[model samples]
Target chain A: MSGKYKDVAYYPGCALEGTGHAYNRSTKEVGKALGLKITELKNWNCCGAMEVKNVDPKLQTYLSARNLSIAEEMGYKTVMAPCNGCYHNLKKAEYDLAHDQNSREVTDRLSRKAGHKTYEAGKVETIHALDWIKEEIGEEGLKARVKNSLNGLKIANYYGCMYTRPRHIFPEKDQGPGSESTSKPHFMDDLLAAAGAENVDYPLKTACCGGAHTLSDSDTSTKLVLNLLTTAEACGADVIATECPTCHTGLEMHQARAEKVFGRKTKVKILYFTQLLGMALGLSARKVGVQENFSDSMDLLRERGLY
Target chain B: MPIHEKSLIRPENLVTHEHLEIEGVDVSGHWSTFINTRAVSDYNEQMQEEIAALPGGEYIHRCWQCGSCTNACTVNAINPDFNPRYWIYLIRMGYESELLRDKDIIWQCVSCNKCTYACPRDVFPEGVMKATAHWLELKGHTEKKPSMVFDETFSEQVFATGKIEDGRVLREFFARTKQSLFQDWLIAMVRSLLMRLPVTLMMKLGLATVFHPRTRGWSKAQAAIDEYVHEREAAARKALRLDVQGAE
Candidate 1:
C-alpha cells in the first residue's frame, strides 16, 4: 500500500453530522484502529447531496467546488469523503470544471462573489471511503491487523448508486485489473473479505436504493430498498455492508417501511463497512457506533461472537 | 409520425370487429384490430427546445431513439410507464399532449443515473428527467410534486445557510407535503435508534435542531447562490414562454 494517503483531508458532509453519525463515528474509529491519519476539512459546507442538482446542476457544482477549494487551501492533495453523495459530487465538480467551460465560468463567478478561492479542476483529488481504505491499507494490511476476524459473518457489500454511476465522473476507476470496476465495485467487498467475512455474490451491488427521493417519493424508495434487502437475504447474507450513508439510511428506513406498508418482512441487517471493519480490528461495538444503527445487529454479532 | 407500438397506442384508438369481414376477406376479431388514425396538430413546436434550455436537458438533441436509457432505467424497471426513451421521443417530436399523459410519474425519477450511464448518445437521460419534471411544473402541466417540494425545501436551507440539519429538512419536507411526521415506519425507525443511542448523541442531535448548523462566514456565499438561482429561474420561465402568460 502506498503512503500517499496515510494522512488526508476528510469531508463528512451533512449526512454524517446528522442521520449518518454512526458512519462518521465508525469511519474515524476504523481509521484510528488502522493507524491512518485523518484531518477534517475545517468549516466545510454541504456538498448539496442529491437535492441541489435538482434545483440547478451548476449550483450543485459550485457547492462542491467550494469544499474542494477549502481542501486546496488546507494544503491537502487528497480529500476523502465518507458519504457517497459528497464523494460523487466532488468528483463531478472536478469533472465538469475540467471539461465544461460553462461550469468553470459559473463556478468561478460564484466563487468570486462568495469571497472564496475558486477551485480549479485537478487541484485536489477526491476519493470515496472505499478507495481511501482499499488503497491506503490494502487487503493484506487489513488481514494482518484483524484481531477478531469476521470469520463466520456473511456480508453482501452494497455499493449503491452514486459511488460508480454515470461513470464519466470517475476517471480513476475501470482501468484494468488493480483498479476499481464501476460496473461491479469490489473495494468494500475486498476490504471485508480481508477482515475474514464471507462476501456474497449480491447482484444489486450497484443498484439504486432511490436515495435521492428516499423521503420525497417514499413508495419507490421503499420498493427499491426492499429489493436490495430481499436480494441480500436471498444471497444468504446476514448483513448488507454499505459504504454510502444515504444507501445505509435508505436501506434501514425502507426496511421498516416495507414491513409496515407492504407487510413483506426481511431479516437482513444493514451495517456500514466501517462499523464491520472497526469490529474486526478489535474495536468494541460501542466504539464503532453499532448501536447507533437503526438495524439491530447485536443479536447476530453476539451469536457470531464478534464482540 | 406517431409511434405504432401496441402499448403506446391508446386502447380507445384500437378498433376491432368482433365478427365481420373486411372487403370480404374474413378479417375479424384480433385480425381486424386496427389503430385509429388521428392527425396530431397540437404539437408544441418549442417543446424540445424548451426542455433543452433547462439544466441537464442540454443534450436532448443528441438522442437517436436508442432504448438503452429506458432499458437501464431504475424507475422503468419497477413501473413500465416510467420510460425515459419514450419521454425523450415525445419531447423531441413536440408531442406535448402525449407527454402530459405521463407528467405526474416523471417527477418520480430517482435520479439514479442508470440512464445516464447507459445512454450511448450522452443524452444524460437522468438530467433530462429532472429537466422534464421542472418543465412540467413551470408550464403548470402538473402541480409541484412531492419530490419537487422536497428539493425546494432542501435547497432553500442550503442557500440560506451553507449547511442543513437533517432533522429540520425532514420535518419541513413532511410539513410542506402535508404529511404527518408520525408515520408508523418513521416512528419505528426512530424508536429503534433511540433504543441504543447514547444520551450524549441524542442531545447533540436534538441541539442541532434548535441551533441549525451553519457555515461560518456563509452570508456572502448564500447571497451569491440566491442571485444565481433567481437568474436560472427567470431564464427557465422565459424559455417555457411562461413569462409572457404572467403565470408564476
Candidate 2:
C-alpha cells in the first residue's frame, strides 16, 4: 500500500453532525482502528449538499471551494470526505476550478469577499473515505488487521447516485484495475469483503434513492428505495451497506415509509460501510454508534454472531 | 399508415370510429383509428434561449435526441411522463404549449444525473430538467414546488449560517410546507432511534436544535454569497424578461 493517506484533513459536512451522526462516528472509529489520522478542518463551512446546487450551482462551487481552502491552509495536500455529497462537491469544485473559467472567477470573487485565500485547483486533492482506506490499507492489509471477521455476513454495497454520476468530476476513477470504476464501484464491496463479508452480486449498486427530493417527494423516494431494498433481498443480501449518509438515512426512512404508506415491508437492514468495518475490527456496536442509526440492526448483528 | 409509438400520441389527438365506412371501404373499429392533425403556432421562440440562460440549460443545444437520457432516467422509469428526452426536444423545438403539459412533474427529475452519465452528446439532461422546472416557476406557469421550498429552506439556513441543523431544517420545512410534523413513518423512525439512543447523545442532539451549528466568522462569506445570489437572481429575471413586466 502507498500509505499516502495515513494523515489527511477531514470534512464531515452538516449531515454528519446531524442526521448522519452514526456514519460520522463509525468513520472515525474505523480510522482509529486502522491507525490512520484524520484532522477535522478547523471552522469548516457547509459543502452545500444537494439543496444549494438548486439555488445556484456556482454558489455550491463557492461553498466547496471554501472548505478546500481550509484544507489547504491546514497544510494538508489530501482532504478526505466520508459523505458522498461532500466528496462529490469537493471534487466537482476542483474540476470546475481547473476547467471552467467562469467557475474560477466566481470562486475567486467569493473568496476575496469572504476574506480567505482563494482555493486554486491542484492545491489539495480530495479523496473519499473509501479511497482513504482502500489506497492506504488494501484488502490484504485489512485482512491481516481483522480482529473479529465479518464471517460471511451477506452485504449489498450500495454506492448511490452522487458517488459516481455525471462522471466528469472524479478524474482519478476508471483508470484501469487498481483505480475505482464509476460504472461498477467495488471499493466498498472490496473493503467489506476484506472484512469477511460475502459481497452479493447486487445490480442496483448505482441506483438513485431519490435522495435529492426524499422528503419533498416522499412517494418517489419510497418507491426508489423499495426497489433497492427488494433487489438487495432478491440477491440474498442480509444487509445493505451504504457509504453515503443520505443514502443510508434514505434507505432507512423510506423503508419505514414504504411499509407505512405503500404497505410494502422490506427487512434488509441498512448500515454504513464504516460501521461494518469498525465492527469487524472488534469495536463494539455502541463504539461505532450503532445505537444512533435509524434502523435497528442489533438483532441482525447478534444473529450473525458479529457482536 | 398508423403513427409510430401510438402510446405517445395524446388521447385527444387519437380519433377512432366504431362503425364507419371511408371511401367505400369498410374501415371500421380497429381499422378506423386516425390521428388528428393540428398546427402548433404558439411556439415561444424565446423559450429555448430563456431556459438556456439558466445554469443547467446551457448545454441544451448539444442534445441530438439520442433518447439515452430518457432510457437512463430514474424518474422516467417510475413515471413514464417524466421524459427528459422529449422535454429537451420540445424545448429545442420551442413547443411551449406541448411543454406546459408536464410542468408539474418536471421538478420531480430528482437530479439523478444518470442521464448525464449515459449521454454521449454531453446534454446534461438532469440540468436541463432543473432549468426547465425553474423556467416554469419563473414564467408563472406553476407555483413553487415543495422541492423548491425545501431547497430554499435548506439553502437559506446555509446562506445565513454556514451550517444547518437537521432538526431545524425538518421542522421549518414541515411548517413552511404545511405538512404535519407528526408523520407516521417519521415518528416511528424517531421512536426506534430514541429507544436505542443513549441519553447523552440524545441530549446532545436536542441541544443542537436549540443552538444551531454555525461556522465561526462566517458572516463575511455569507454576505458575499448573498450578494452573488441576488445578482444572479436579477440576471435570471432579466434573461426571462420578468423585470420588464415587474414580476417577482
Candidate 3:
C-alpha cells in the first residue's frame, strides 16, 4: 500500500452481499494483490438503490447520506463503492446536499430523527472502484505488477448507465485530458489494457443493459442485452468486461433468458473487470469466485490457459 | 432513424387508394396516400402540473421540445413507441387522451438516464418518465405495472428495515405480482450457480434467507421515512385531484 489511495473505506452496499458476491470477492482479491487496504464502512445501510428513488427521491438521498455520515464518523476522508448504483446514489446525494435546499432540509430532519450525526456535503468524497484503481495504481504500475498477463484475452469494456449519466451528479468526471468521459468512459479500458488484454472497438460501451426492469420487462431487457451480447461478439470480443454488479448480472441473466424464452442464444461470456484483473495478477479463477457467477466463464478461461 | 421524426404518423392515420383518379391525376397505389386530419380535444389542462407535483418531475416546465431525450432514450431504441419526447410533448400540451393511447408501455423507461444526459434544457427526462409512469397508475389510466409493484415491494422492505435482503425482495415481488418463484430460466441459473458454489458459501447464502440482514438501530430512521412517504403520497394524491379515498 504505497499510493495515494493505499487505504480507503469500502461500502459494498447490499447487492455485493448477494447477487454480486463474485464482484465483492474479486474486488478484494485484486486489492490484496495490489497491496491496498480497504476498510468497510461501519454498519452502513442501503443506499436506496434504483427502487427507493422511484418511491421518493429525497428518501433515497437521505439513505445514501446516512452511509456517508457513517463514513465521516469513522474518520475517513474517502469512501469507495464498487457497485455503480451505490456509487451513483452517493454522488447524487452529495450533489443534492450541496445544491438543493429541499434535499438538505429532508436529510437534516431524517438524520436528527435517526439520532445519527448529520452528514454535511464535502465531509467525505465518494469514489468508484474504477477511480480508486485508476488513481491509486496507475496503468504503468499495473503493467509492472502483472505476473500472468491477460494475453490473447479480447475484452469489450462495458461501463453501463449509472457509472456516467445525468452528468450533473458526477462533477469530478469530464475534466479535460485524463479524466473519465461521460459519453466514452475509458477507466476500465485503460486498466484492462495495462493488464495486457486486447480491448475491442466497442461502440456501445456506455449502452444500457436495462438492469432497472430486468424482471418487470423481461422481453425488453432480453432484446437490449441481446444487442449488447451480439454486438460484443460482432466486435470479436470473447468476454465483456463489466464494472457494475447490476450490469454484469443483468447481462448474464438475460443471456440465459434470451435462450430460454426468446430462443436467441449468444455465447459471449460476462466477467467483472476486477475478476479479470485478479486473474492477470496470477489469482486463480476459483480464487476470484468466477464459479459463483451466473455466467460460467471457466471453460473459456481454461481454454485460454488463464487459470 | 431514432423514431422521433416520424413516430407521430400512425398506420391508422394513413389513407391509401387502391385505384383512384383525382381530376385525371391517376393518384393510385403508393402515390395515393393521405394522412387523416387529426383534431385533438379533451385536453386535461392540469396534466403537466399533476406530474410536476411528483418527486422527480419538478423540472418538466424546462423542456423545449429539442427531441434530444427521444434520440438518446434506451427503450426508444428497442421499441419506437416508447418515445419520451412525444410523451413530454403530449403532457405539456395537455393531450391526455392521446397520451392514454400508449399508456401500457410507458412504464418501461428502464431509468437509464441517457435522455437526461442528452437533454440540453436540463429537463431530467428520466425523472419525467418515472413521473409519467407514476401518474398513469395514480390517475387510473392503466393498471399498476410490474415495475411499480416491484418498486413498492422493494420500498416497503427498505422502510421496514434500513437494509433489504435480495431474497426477500424477490420473493415478495413475485408473490405480489402473481408470478411463480420457480421459473425455468431462474431455476437453471440458480442450479448452475449452486453447482460451482462451495459448501460453506452455500450454507452462508441459505442462512442469509433465514436471518434476514438488517441495520442496527434503524427504527428511528424507519419512522422518519414512513412519515415522509405518507406526506408525499398525500401531496401527490392532492395534485392528481384524487380524494382521501383515492377517488377522482
Candidate 4:
C-alpha cells in the first residue's frame, strides 16, 4: 500500500451504519478497487453529527475529540471521515481545542472522567474522503484506472454544508492552487470528470439540503431538497454526485416528500460520488451497494449500460 | 435610549382614511395615510446578554449590522419574514417585543452557515440563531421547537449508546412530533429500496435493528457524557434564569 491515504483511519460515524449504508459500502469498495487500505477506527463512537452541538458545543467537541484521540492512540496521524458532518465535526473539534482554552479544559475534564487520554489538538489531522482521493490519487491517476468510463452520464457534484462553511474551521481550503475552495468546491467534479462523466454547471452546488432538520422540519427540508433536485435537473444532470451521506439521504427522502406532499416531482437521481466512481472503476451496482440507497437509480444505470 | 419611532410607511403602524378631504384639498385617497404614534419603553435590558450567554450565540456582540447574513441566508430565500439581520438588530437593541414578532421562525435557521460565511464581522450568525431559538424557548415565548426536539432525541441516543441508529432516531422523532410512520413519500422511498435490496443484506439490516450497533466498552464514555450534559443543561438554565425544572 502507498504510505499515504492507502491506509488511513476511517471514521464512518453513525449514519453509515443505517441510512447511509450505500455510502459505507461504496466508499470501501472504491478504496479496495483503487488498491487503497482503510483501517477502521477501533471502537469509534459518534462524532456528534450536527445534533450534539445544539445541546452543548463543547460536548460535541469532546465527542469528536474522543474519536481523534483514538486515531492518535492507534498511531495514525491522519483520520479520514467520509460523512460531511463527521469530517466537519472532527475539524471543528481540532480547531476549538487549539484555539479555545475552554474547549480544551472541558475536553480534558471529560476525557479524565471517561478514563481515556485527552485528545490534544495537532496530534492528528482530519481529512475528508474527497481529499483522500484527490490528494492520494490525482485526476490523472484516476483517469488511467477507469475501466468502464461514464461515457454519457451527466453529473452535478453537490458538496453540502459542513464540508466547507464558517470558513475558519477549514483552514487548509481556499489556499492558492492544489487546495479545495470553500465557496466553490470542485474535487468531486475533478474526480468525476476523470472518470469520463460530463459535469453540468450547477449553481446550488454548495446549497444546504436542510439535513439538519430533515426530520425536525420536514416541509423546510422538502423545499430545500426540491430546489436542489430541480436545479440539478435543470442543469441537465442525470445524477447528483454526493459526498455526504446526510445530503444523499436528504435528497432521496425529500425528492419523494416533495412529490408526495408538495406535488413538486423532480427526476434527478442522487448517488454517492464513491458509488459513481465505483461503477466507473468496473464494480457492479450491487457490489457498490446501490440497492441499499433509498433512491433507486437502477433504471437509469441500466439505460446508460452502467449496471 | 432613543425613542424608536413607528415608521410612517409601515402598514401595521399606518392609518388610512378613504373618501375624506384633508384641509379641503380633496386629498382623500392616497394622501390620507397617517402613522399611529406610540412611546417605546418596554425593552428587555438583559435580552442581548441572555442570548449571548447561550453556546452558539457568543459572538453575536461582534455583529456590525451588515445585511450580509440575511442576504445569504437559506431560509430567507424562501420566506422573506425569516430575516436574521432584523432579528440581530432587535436582540442587540433589546427590542424584545419586536423580536417576539418572529419568535416562531427563529429556530428554522437550518445551520446553513451562509450567514457565518457572508459576515465580515465573524459574528457567527448561524450560532446566534440557534442561541436565540434556545433563548425564546427558555423565556416561555415559544414551546420547544421540532428542531430542538430532534436535537435532544438524537443527542440522548448518542449520549446513551455512544452511537445512534438513524432508523431508530427517525422513528422516535416522528413519534415525539406526533407524526405517522406511514407517510406516503416515506413508504414510497422504502418501497423503492426494498425492490432492489438483496435478501441477505435485508436480513443483516433486520438483525442490526434487533441488535443495535454500539461501541464496545462505551459505558465509561456514556456516563461521562450524561454527567456533562446534565451539568451543561443546568448551567444553560442558570444563564437563562430558569429554575432547575426549566421554569422561569
Return the TM-scores of chain A for each candidate in numbered order: 0.99, 0.99, 0.99, 0.98
Candidate numbers sorted by DockQ from highest down: 1, 2, 4, 3
Scored by TM against the true chain B, the candidates give 0.88, 0.87, 0.86, 0.88
In candidate 4, what are the lDDT values of residues B206-235, reduced to their tens digit?
888788888788888888888877787788
Top candidate on DockQ is 1
Judge candidate 1 at residue A177 and give its lDDT: 94
Quality of candidate 3 docking, DockQ: 0.74
**Distance from true position, residue B128, model 3, in Å?**
0.7
Candidate 3 ranges beyond 4 A from true positions:
B1-37, B245-248
Q: Model 3, A56: alpha-carbon shift in Å?
A: 0.8
lDDT of 3 by residue, A115-145 (tens): 9988999999999999999999979989999
Model 4, position A72, has a per-residue lDDT of: 97
Per-residue lDDT of candidate 1, residues A29-100 (tens digit): 999988889999999999898899998999999999999999999999999999999999999999999999
Q: Calculate DockQ per candidate and list them.
A: 0.82, 0.81, 0.74, 0.79
Candidate 3's docking class is medium
Cα lDDT of model 4 by residue, A1-307, tens digit: 1357777899998888888888999999999998888899999999888889998899999999999999999999999999999999999999999999999999999899888999999999999999999899889999899999999599999999989997999999999898899999999999999999999999998999999999888899999999999899989999999999999999999999998999988888889999999999999998998878888788999999899
